[model samples]
Target: MNKNEDSVKNSEFGFGESNDAYAKYFFGQSYLKRLASNSDEKINVSNVSFEPGCRNNWHEHSIAQILIAVAGEGWYQAEGQVAQKMLPGDVVIVPAHTKHWHGADKDSWFAHLAIMVGDAKTDWYESVDEAEYEKLN
Candidate 1:
């Protein structure tokens, strides 16, 4: 397979059907591959890909997170706020315990290097309401 194809295949990890009400119901064009696991480093590191309309539920970390978009376009939305468009080379730092959600836009594929500090906790909350998400588009 080509390098890009390999990358796509490698990005899938731990991600399965979304049980939450707001979880993306259709995989459609979206894709995710987990390139690395917690075994590879002191902290948890994941390579994730989001096809258009794919996104994580609202959540936060006990420790801060640093997201570096390696390819395509995406967006991040914090609780009670709007989402900001992200592009290649964009780096996002989410403070500890900050509620937010992020993923690829409705029309583009997005991938990022997800780095999470160790021993931290992730608190999942409600999905971003569609009305709120629509504002970002």
Candidate 2:
């Protein structure tokens, strides 16, 4: 038997089934891989992937949320702020109750490891305006 077989096996790293429950909060498509969803554990985590031109609505968390960019490129922006480019190894710490949004760039597939601290409840809001999104340069 090959000892390296585990590493060689094909796997779905980022791409996965779409999460339809929050479909209304996103544009294009996105996938969710729940790594941890137990509140008793104190911290929850997930692996999220965004297709090109896909993004979630403006939202906020009750406590705080951290996103560790792990693959490709994407954009992150807080309310009334310029959109910031995010690449692998980038880390974003969103303060509690601050409205923000994140997703893949128009031409990139993006993935991130999301870590939520405390019992933060995500407050999702309105979708991004396409006209305004197009103006993002």
Candidate 3:
């Protein structure tokens, strides 16, 4: 088959169900499912785990991101805002350049699948302040 035809076929085709070893860590675990784009677009798919007392540094995105809670519970908050409690089946859409942080509760486990689009490099920032976090929870 020709290259163009192959491209169309591949796009039309789909990947069957699969999974990976959820990476374990103090903050929690993460499993990178796969890269979203086959050719050149910048898209990512990852399964993240936030253990009890685990959280991520407050950061902003060059593009947008989508977070889908697959299991457990957690919270998400954007810059200059209150945090929202999240549960299974919840979805969060974070706009570009909006600083935010998310993680599991102090005594609970949380897991979610996150997808990001745009420039792949993520700009990291300081960890969420304990005082500020307490206010949200």
Which is the leading candidate under lDDT?
Answer: 2
User: After best superposition, candidate 1 residue 42: deviation in angstroms?
Assistant: 3.2
Q: Could you give the C-alpha RMSD of every candidate to the true structure, in order shown?
A: 5.4, 6.2, 11.3
lDDT of each: 0.67, 0.78, 0.63
Ranking by TM-score: 2, 1, 3
lDDT of 3 by residue, 1-137 (tens): 32122222232222212223322212343323443553366667766655455677787778889998765667888988778887867999999888888876655566667788667555777777777666655
Best of the two (1, 3) by lDDT: 1
Clashing pairs in 2: none
Better of 1 and 3 by TM-score: 1
Alpha-carbon TM-score of each model against the true structure: 0.72, 0.84, 0.71
| lDDT accuracy of residue 83 in candidate 3 | 86
User: What is the C-alpha lDDT profile of model 1 across 31-98, one tens digit per residue?
Assistant: 44445556545576766676666677788888899898776677887787667888867999999989
Clashes of each: 5, 0, 0
Over all chains combined, what TM-score does candidate 1 have? 0.72
In model 2, which runs have C-alpha deviations exceeding 4 angstroms?
Answer: 1-14
Arrange candidates by lDDT, descending. 2, 1, 3
